[model samples]
Target: MKRSLSLPGIAYGGDYNPEQWPEEVWAEDVRLMREAGVTLVSVGIFSWALLEPSEGVYDFSRMDRILDLLHANGIAADLATPTAAPPAWFFRAHPEALPVDRDGRTLSYGSRQTFCPSSPAYREAALRIARELARRYADHPAVVMWHVHNEYGCHNAECHCDTSAEAFRAWLRDRYTTLDALNEAWGTTFWSQRYHDWDEILPPRATGAVPNPTHRLDWRRFCSDALLALYTAERDVLREAAPLTPATTNFMVMHNFDALDYWRWAPELDIVSNDHYLRSTDPESEIDLALSADLVRSLAGGPWLLMEHSTGAVNWQPVNRAKRPGELRRNALAHVARGADGIAYFQWRAARAGAEQWHSAMLPHAGTDSQIWRDVVRLGADLKALSQVRGSAGTAEVAVVWDWNARWALELPSQPSEEVRYLDTVRSWYEPLWRSGVAVDFVRPDADLSAYRLVLAPALYLVDDAGAANLTGFAERGGTLVVGFHSGMVDENCHVRLGGYPGAFRAALGVRTDELFPLLPGETLGLTGEVPAGASATLWSERLRFEGAEVIAAYADGPLTGVPAVTRHGWGAGTAWYLATQPDAVTLAALLDRIRTEAGVEPVLDGIPEGVETARRRGQDADYLFLIDHGGRGAELRVPSGATELLTGERIEDGVLTLPPGEVAVVRHPR
Candidate 1:
């Protein structure tokens, strides 16, 4: 695995926008940063309006001062291209730069990401700015990495104007080659939607005929491609100017956007980065963040960056709640515990005026020296002392296949319950592994499965023949497999296979499922044999007939009461288990406990309490244990003998380690 960017201790600093403040404030900002143990500051985010006020006008005088100030303070800066949002003048001059909504209404320049990615005017202007930034800042000592357009796909789709239509047609031609090939791939003959000419294809939006499934799918693909093309244009400009500095764009994990197919764009990035936000305080939140980090790390096959996070409460949600005292530190450490190399926040100073003025920031509107600022400084100090953890990578014995193609194909089907979401199912399986303290790699379906003794592919909806055969080979070779409901139901083209559900894995799983029942919201089905209270028995229930498998649990009530809800089958030296219904957390945890024991996957720590997560990473000679307390109250954790706290310099040997709420500790085992 490639090494991540994070050093051993902790990474310090937050967003810094010198453009928003005066020259005198820059010095004060640096002083405050140093005081807070801030080692890095992200500059130039949302500075397009200041950088370029008009067409053909370029200004970097202020940015130069900002860089000089940071360098003087010995701080590293993650510089942005200032291309996330073009100036209003550019959009006004080239009206085509405006994006059009799904209903065909052209968007105004009131919001960010309003520029149409397909518009030549926007692309040309964005590339020019990017080239200028790269050329000007390539040799600056303060600069660490180049951050491309912020969070690439906030816009759902782009303009349906003539320019976009022509580009869409070109994209289709490249993908299908000929009109006949396009017709066959989309299976357009079913709805008499066969296209005689490429021009017949129109952008799928809320406007026209509600769109056929094939066109809708292609439109999503086309939109993602367009955005990626935009990203590549800027990336090429930067690469030509400064090949040494790493180039990357912050990605949103499991977002509605098709950008998750980083496999298509991974080569363009020197380091993969993502912005993580969680809504719930449940254990799943940490698992989701870790999964995203693992995905990015797997993409580059190395360490990735935690590009953006809320220093406190974010303003985007309906209710913005600040991060509890130690939550920020705990969260940052959580990323490192996974595979994050670099850590940075969204904004350095809170906005003084505007929609996001109330959003979380490292420096509140009040100058500095607040509690938040103190925590920021402490985090910085910790990071500087602990840079030794940089090259550490997690040890994962199990891998979960997270395929975007399968996700898209499965959701496009008309029959399955909407409650059976792709992300939820993946998370359900992942939660157990995470809670059990077993590191997992969120790999692609085609990734080498031999490295893992256990493989979990929940909701493998779009199982191509090759993919299914791959799983079969793994099972035959003594690798345990677990698959859930709504799996093996369709091919890549969204067409259901005949015979029965789980068509291809029938022999491997040793079972056949013909009928699936969709339960309404809040409906409760029961599970036989000591099922936990509030366990969901009927989200997507299936009738099963075991060919060779033994039933482990069955429905306690309903027409299928006494039928199977869980089954296990032995195949070769390995085994296959099928979960026919969505169960509650307790039941899921219980099921995972059994699976973990059977697979012999070891946990990193024992006697860890709830809300306290444990993860371990090993260097050549030492093992590092990351203990994070996400619980409400402080914890007195017991550490193994002969270990030392890397952060606090305290020696521990099966003694109580005090951890305040939301606190984290990195314990290095004796060499």
Candidate 2:
């Protein structure tokens, strides 16, 4: 009884909210589902109010009919625990369960995810509902997977209420048994914030000034763990009731979500799934999608599912821009190309009323006659044609270190420059690699880098002892490593590493910087030597005394003009390069190009037109080369001798395939 037994090739369909519609519409839902080739539907995700009208009174009658209809129509179910949204009755009884904001305002129950993660009443009631749900339908034939608690920590990542304070104390006690250890770790002597008693410490509510960085850091960690505890409690109940079915919670791994350290959370789940939507503000949101997909695939170490996306516009942004025609197909295929086994949207049908009423879905409000609906049907067929690539894995020869701990430390209230955004710096390095057609995988700093030929650490401002050693060892063991500005400045405690800049990696990089001279607003500087022509720098520069390293580039005109802006060192059998300042796009791309050649890393395909996205996922029998013309350029590439393009059924014997602008091709060749 394997969990994969029920998967219909690449599982299709999205969140099916039968609870939102009447019974009569459910019949139409099933008919349309079959017509669209849907194989699965996530049921009852936010149905606690419908299922549990009153305390100790359970109703499974409605859910029974929904599951029956779905099963009768040959659609599998990703059954949910319904713990994300606690019933209004439960909140009315235990009003203290509502989360309190940092400004001491109690969040009302009108919005979703109103319950505090640390509330005992919430934990008990959520577990009970999960237990009851499992008892009723765990053995049902339609239940293929158990989805426990939707999007944990999406809204209330932290709470400052009394119950949370108590739980925080308990968590801290477990982390640091004594008051002295807690004081030492948090560095409380700076502003007379040392704790003599464990209960004396409280959540950093709104104060006159910024709170301790270490305190904020630890609280972030505790918040992630608190929600994780809720997920595990429900997951255990579902696991006991249904031993064969796997359980997962959709992760928000896109640019905006940084609350949860997914590395700590990914190992606890049976599958790694993520919900990603287009950041409509960015013109090239597809690159953001690629970054998120690669991160999820790396977390799973193989294939994963695209839990939720949008067919068109999302309702949340200030100006929700709709996806243009053909953008939908390209987005879905890009996820699959990066290693998504299945593609799904936020919901199956558009909501006529609700907070997210305007969010797009599989079946738009305009019905099947619309372009969105047609694209959905076409994408479903294309996924079925890609059934052979379900377990296939991406071939990422390069790795980039992306850690939440460092990110949290970097974004603290006080820093060199407020403009040195964390995600922006990471993306600056990743974009060039994507443009070059190379596959990239995001990794934790201490993860085994032996597999990759090149590793990039952009704006990795924080590093602990183990992480520092792992990075330095990779460079010493013949793996080329690149570190960006402001990295290795502090230890895990947010305490500066004392003597020089980049304390943790100074020895490995063979460069020493006494201080940092971050640029002012609207400032820019030029660089010369071993870099692309007209290479400019911005945001940051440092007093680099690169005595032991070779100066690859130097500031041509700035405050620290003529200083070593970029340096390289041959440490042991490998190489370590450091960029003292953030270089412009062309310079960074040229730098990566030189590094790739030196490290012997190759892109998925070479000599392709610019703006075309490329990725190769290798199955046991064949390698699928995904060529997506995201750049809107007609292009040609040399294909394998007898490769066949899956999308159009075109055979290639002359070893060349030409693609028109906005076209997509999946070329299959021997693995």
Candidate 3:
């Protein structure tokens, strides 16, 4: 069930809003698209108001002309349903369709995604528009994929209104089946909050004290399902109209934005596509992009599409820094190396006005003679040369387990530390592998770990019995397991497991912690022994008593000095290592290097220095390795002498690859 466009080479180009400009501008857009080598363009994403002016009146003349023009120019269309934003008239007429925030304030319709997902009026109107668009573009020559509703849960993931409350109650009924079961799962006996009837439950609102953690967690899950239900209602209509056209919706799968469990959403999407934007201020933003791409690939179970990214300077960030001379090309190639079959930007041409007016584009407001334009043309040509790598997937020896449910649980109020974020801790573990040039895959806790030599779970705060058994079985079956601090303390309902910290994995991890001593801001703990000197634990630490596990590293000085800061337990054929504190970068790198050696996990490319990354895509006929040097400092790499270099078409008998800052090389070798 792999999904891709029929066109040749990596699909390029981005969102094209012909409705925003006059008909005269459409031709120039096509001509520039041809010059830029654009093979695909997503159209009509936010043109809901323009498409349908009134209740039953829709104007398709402009859309038809746009599709025809794109087809004439040899470009395919990922036609959008245009239901992301309801028309102002529709929202005004059906005011019940508006969403209410947690504080019980109705969200106005000026911004997009303001409709309630569970509102009957909104769903009906959205479906009507979707069906009309699907029927119109079903067999159109320009249409290749049906993009149903732009990024779900972007703004209105939760709505605390009567309609949503009814829908959430129904969703809970379907899950729990009865009130008794719901009470037991929620542990509602505490605080005299047990619900006698389904209607008594409510969405977690901002209260003087913390709301019930179970209720908040379930509400987040319900909101995700409600949005998914809306997506499916429109997707089914599209499938019925255009049975052959693949259906997808761009997902915003960034850190701290896991309201929707994409693992559940993946099966519904024919091609898992994602919208990724870099934090311009973060020096390691490239690492976040790679992690996001890897996650999207895992969700798709194969190659996915980079549906939306900025060429430079996105408007929403505090500091919208422009990309350097070669950074745009470097960024796109990074996604391609991570298994993105298509590289696309948010818009083909810069918007003259609106919220994203300052957002950079392929053809910026400076017209076709800009550095951005040149970079776009060069990337198109480079993608054409590297087309053979399409449909190939990157393989990894390490798997990092992620649970959106746990993330939801962690974000609830009243945690020990304000700095303990699920994604940040996960990235802390991933940085070591990334710096070592080892490719890693993100997986669910229940995913099969047989294919991986090492599995790392960093802040899995919520773990069910099955999750615990899975990790135990993996370690017992000869795979090294690394568990981070503040993990395994709660069950599915966010209830404490009671016996000790890290409740379920206590036996498997062979350690017990009686106290959690979270460090205050600007606080640090000294570490000594086998660990690196001057290395200190920051953010968090635990007082531990090892059970058959050896103390690898102990705190040199702190409230919990001489306690085991790190422990290793041999369970059957493998070992389980626990890090009771957030170690410094140097300590983490050393610990990961030791584990990588013990597990026999090797890097994709050896001797690759910092700022140089490598990813391999295995095809049936040959294997291609993509090496990217993000840093300006040059590095030399050894490669197959007789391999074909795709970028330069140079088949050298003695190739010694050298990359000088911001250079990318794709080498193809015979299988």
Better candidate by TM-score, 1 or 2: 2
lDDT of 1 by residue, 1-671 (tens): 22133223445665677777767777777787777777766789789888877877888888888898888888888788888878889877998778777678887887788877788888889888888888899889888777788887776445676778888999999998999988987888975888998888877757435356666667667877898988888877887877767777888775345544567777777778778876634434666776767777777665677777877888777777777667777778888777776677867888888778888787876656577777777777666655777767777778787777777766663656777788878877888777777778777666678878788888788777888878767878888888787787767666677888677777788888888777888887888764566555647787888889888888888878787888888888888888878877789888877876788777778777777888877777888888887776767877778788988988886666887777788888855
lDDT of all predictions, in order shown? Answer: 0.76, 0.90, 0.88
By lDDT rank, best first, the candidates go: 2, 3, 1
C-alpha RMSD values across all candidates? 2.6, 1.2, 1.1
lDDT of 2 by residue, 122-150 (tens): 99999999999999998899999988888
- lDDT (C-alpha) at residue 540 in model 3: 92
Question: Per-residue lDDT for 650 in model 3?
Answer: 80
Among residues 3 or more apart in sequence or in different chains, the pairs in candidate 3 whose N, CA or C atoms overlap within 3 Å are none
Candidate 1 residues lying further than 4 Å off, grouped into runs, are 1-10, 156-159, 207-210, 254-259, 280-284, 529-536, 633-638, 654-662
Q: List the candidates' TM-scores in order.
A: 0.94, 0.99, 0.99
Give stretches of model 2 more than 4 Å off: 1-5
Cα RMSD for candidate 1? 2.6
lDDT of 1 at 619: 70
Candidate 3 residue-wise lDDT, 246-348, digit = tens: 8889999884577798888989988889999888767888888888888888888778899999888888877889997688998999999988899999899
